[model samples]
Target: MKVAYWPGCVSRGFTPELHGSMALVGPRLDLEMVELNRANCCGAGVIAEHNQELVDTLNARTFALAQQTGASMMNICSTCQGAQSECQQRLDADDAYREHINTHLEPEGLRYEKGGDWSNKNLLWLLVEEIGLDKLRERVVRPLDGLRVAPFYGCYIVRPTGRLGYDRFPHRDKYLEHVIETVGGTAVEYAGSHKCCGFPVITMAKATSLRQAGRHLADAIDADADCLVTPCPLCHLNLDLQQPDAAKYVERDLNIPVLHLPQMLGLAFGLDPKELGMDKHVVKTRDVQRKVAELAAA
Candidate 1:
């Protein structure tokens, strides 16, 4: 299937591995990821607080760009998905507001018509709903047998059900768990699986952010999970990149490796760890790699 892929700012900059892994996995799953290279940022919710109109305009511009592709828009970042989806929902409901936003795009020759032929869905939704578990299972050349994976949903992707679709399909709450099992990995149940990773408040309250990140890591560790996988790059930043600082806040050495959703899928698809950018992670993924390798060899 063809999709207008929105890599988002974080995936392109902060977490290039997520983008790289997605590139490697998309073709393997028969997905044509036509990147919206000219697309701008989704405001990531920060801009919405300062200027709602600006956020709406920016997202509307992106939607206009996606419309030209003649395919449904798909985001790899949860923040981008939430921000754009929220704006799209509002624009679709209020015709006058959408027209106001379109005025800003008129100069660029772009128009985002509400209730158009295109819709938006994040990578997680596409994987579970569009691709199907049976199709994913068939593509798993190297099953992650004996590996325990903790699913970290973070926020944005699952909440505000009206915009993100949890109200229509409650089963989406278990998408990460289902994907884990499809790749032959045991889904480790933990309290922090659906909780926020504290990325939003990291700048405003450093200590609180650290505590939240540490607690999530601790919960996954306490559950005996081999590694934690998250769909949001911001969550991965808090849980993986900031883990050392978070360990100081919680008074424990929290060194659990955090993998992006695509990276985990790439591993199961028999892709190399380096190709998936596993070595670039702050918390080393060697343990997870070793476990998967041993299982595949056996």
Candidate 2:
């Protein structure tokens, strides 16, 4: 399966490792990812809070790129997926808005068709539906047998169907767990699996965001999860980068390591941790790597 990849702004700027790991893992799964050329940010969710029209125009350009690529555009970041996909739906449904966006695209020789034959897929959804869990299992050279990974599906990626978008078919909450099991790891249940990681409010409400993230970490610790895995780079940031603050907020030393989904899958694919850029994480992946080695030995 081939798709155009949009790594999004934050992942390109703050989490290049996510892209690195995906590039490594995709070939193993028979998934060919071509990075979308001249693609821009898909509003990052925060932009809509300030300017809705700007968000629509910017994301319409992104869709035009996907349309030009001839394959559906795939996003590694949850916010980018949500923003662009929601914008696509909006532009398709609203005639006046579509015309307005097209007027902006006309100068660049790009025109977004209201009935455009393209899709904006999230990586998690692409893996589960397109690649199939059995195919993913077949690519697992080193099964992560005995590892308990807690799946974290941060806020924006999964919802607002009742608000602004459509419901994710086949249920999105199970996508992470499916990928975890496909790589031979146990997906442990935790309260924060479906809760927000508090990333969206991090800028405006730092204390509240830390407390919320702390609550999720506390849940994961209680569940005895070895580490947390997330599809969203922003969620990874909140749970991984803000871990220190979260520990202070909860008044406990939460030593849990966080892994981007691709990084965790790379370990199962028998790729080197260094190649996956595991060391760049705020929370170390050394322990996770050590555990994977032991699992391979067993």
Candidate 3:
């Protein structure tokens, strides 16, 4: 399936492993990613606080770029997916609003036309909807049989059901668990799986963000999960990159490995850990790697 792939700022900059892992695994799944290189940021809901119109205009331009590719839009970042989807919903519903946004695009000769077959979805949605779980299971060369993986669905991807397609995909909440099971990993159900990783408020409330991250990590550990997998790079940034700081806040040694969803799939596809950028994570994935390796060797 061909898609106008939008590697959001977080994946492209903050967590390159997430982006790299997707690059390595996308072709294996026959997902042709036509990157929207010229596209600008989706604002990730941060910019919207100051200027909602500006955010919509920026996203409309991105949609226009995706339209030029003549393929459906796909985002790796949950923040980007939510921001774009929200804007797309507005544009689709309000004709006058879309026309007003198009005026800004006129300078660049780009206009986003709604009511087409074109759609916007995140990588998780693509894996479950476009590439069926049954098909994905068949492609697993290295089954994660002994691994207990926890699924973390950060706010944007699953919430606001109307924009994120949760209403249409009623069982979408379990999609991550299905993928984990398909890869032969035990899905560890935890309370923090669907909560925020606190990335949105990190800049303003660092301590609160760290506490939230610590809570999620502790929840996963308490649930006996070997590792946590998240579709959102921002969540990974907080859960993995800031884990040590979070430990200080929570008063515990939280060393759980957080994997980007693609990295988990890459491992199941028999791709090397280094190839999937697993070694680059802040919270070392060595334990998860060794466990998977031992299981594969058995």
Candidate 4:
């Protein structure tokens, strides 16, 4: 019931609503989430690709903070989960890397006491495992009756099961849809739900990111989804923020609303539009908000 949550850099800044909504929604589902006092980046940004040592040291800081809670850690960012997920395999297989990581933390007097390595959990797993479907079903204030949601998995979040085991349960749509159902929403079956969302190719080349994103969007739109949702902020960036650029590259316009799973859940929990931070996104949530209001009224 008690767990620590790590909201990676983007979630802290651009996706405040998702984080805020998690705090609001988790407790209602009987999860007592303890946020790390000084939750920092999980050493993901460019460190993971360029420097292994820096990645370890940087992430050790987050581990150090989560260990402070003395409870299992639940994570919001898929990339952060991937980093921590990756370290799980290292800490288990290579004592040298693990010890060196801990040694780096010694100067700060922070020790990595491993009864087990960080219990890196994704929000979906936490809901399915920690809070059962029955409890989820009990929380529905507004059901997504007519809405068909497209679940986007992207990549890092679901691969390499060293963390949330999302790979084992590789259906991103179902989890969001489950919560959607709890609030009376229909989790519409759709194609492109498990596509990569172009995370790897995004920053490497604009063309690559564009083509990949446009294709993914085009597929989702073609599937007749009312809205697209994802747990990963990076995926949200590509699928939501970069859609305009992607559309230009593909030479087509897509007005599809990309919803962060928590943002949708927060609205169902009766959170105000401001509390969900719906305005900060590239695509407006006004129509989505109207639908929710209509659903609740109905």
Across 1-298, the per-residue lDDT of candidate 2 in tens digits comes to: 7888888877777888988898888788777777886888777776787788888888888878877877877888877877776777778778987998789989999977666446777888878777788888888899999899999976767777553234546466678988898898999998889888888888899888988898888899899999999889998888998999888988888878889988988999899989998889888878888998798778
Better of 2 and 3 by lDDT: 3
Question: Model 1, 96: alpha-carbon shift in Å?
Answer: 0.9
Please give, for residues 161-243, the per-residue lDDT of candidate 3 as tens digits: 87777778998778899899999999998889889998888889999999999998999999999999999999999999899
Task: Quickly count the clashes in candidate 3.
Answer: 0
Q: What are the runs in model 4 whose C-alpha is more than 4 Å off?
A: 115-118, 161-174
* Candidate order (lDDT): 1, 3, 2, 4
What is the RMSD of candidate 4?
Answer: 2.5
lDDT of 1 by residue, 139-243 (tens): 999999888999998788888876677777789889999999999999999889988888999999999999999998999999999999998999999999999
TM-score of each: 0.98, 0.95, 0.98, 0.89
Q: Between which residue pairs do clashes occur in model 1?
A: none
Q: Looking at model 2, which ten-residue stretch has the lowest summed lDDT?
A: 161-170
Give the least accurate 10-residue stretch of model 4, judged by summed lDDT: 158-167
State each model's CA lDDT, in order: 0.91, 0.83, 0.91, 0.72
Judge candidate 4 at residue 128 and give its lDDT. Answer: 70
Candidate 2 residue-wise lDDT at 281: 84
Model 3's TM-score against the true structure: 0.98
Off by over 4 Å in 2: 162-168
Q: Which 10 residues in a row give candidate 3 its minimum summed lDDT? A: 158-167
